[model samples]
Target: MKSPTQIINRELKAKKKCQGNPTKKYFKELIDYYINIKTLNEFCFAFLKIKITAKIAIFYFF
Candidate 1:
């Protein structure tokens, strides 16, 4: 199996090949976005939980 760094490098290379001008900053942005999503997933789950609970409460009252 490839190491995490190796996998990341491979992905960056692929992105560069597809885009034709990949920079180190581009890879950095990609990593940042990936991490941001992980953090955002928790927020999304909480939001969904509240939304579902609110819907259930509305149905119960109506």
Candidate 2:
């Protein structure tokens, strides 16, 4: 079975490959969004916190 670290590494690599922007631009934009954010309400609404939590739970189980 793949380790948790292996799964996380795979996910990161996939994200890096699929993400459209250059790495530098992506990080800059992410940093700006985090620094300027007042609340995670919008973020949570977009992502749906419960769904992500369930995903994490499933990952742990696997």
Can you give the TM-score per candidate against the true fold? Answer: 0.35, 0.35
TM-score of 1: 0.35
Candidate 1, which segments miss by more than 4 Å at Cα?
Answer: 1-38
| Model 1 lDDT tens row, 1-62 | 33457545855665675464444444454444344444565446535644564576468656
lDDT of 1: 0.52
lDDT of each: 0.52, 0.48
What is the lDDT, from 0 to 100, of the residue 19 in candidate 2? 77
Give me the candidate number with maximum lDDT: 1
Residue 55, model 1: lDDT of: 70
Residue pairs with backbone overlap in model 2: none
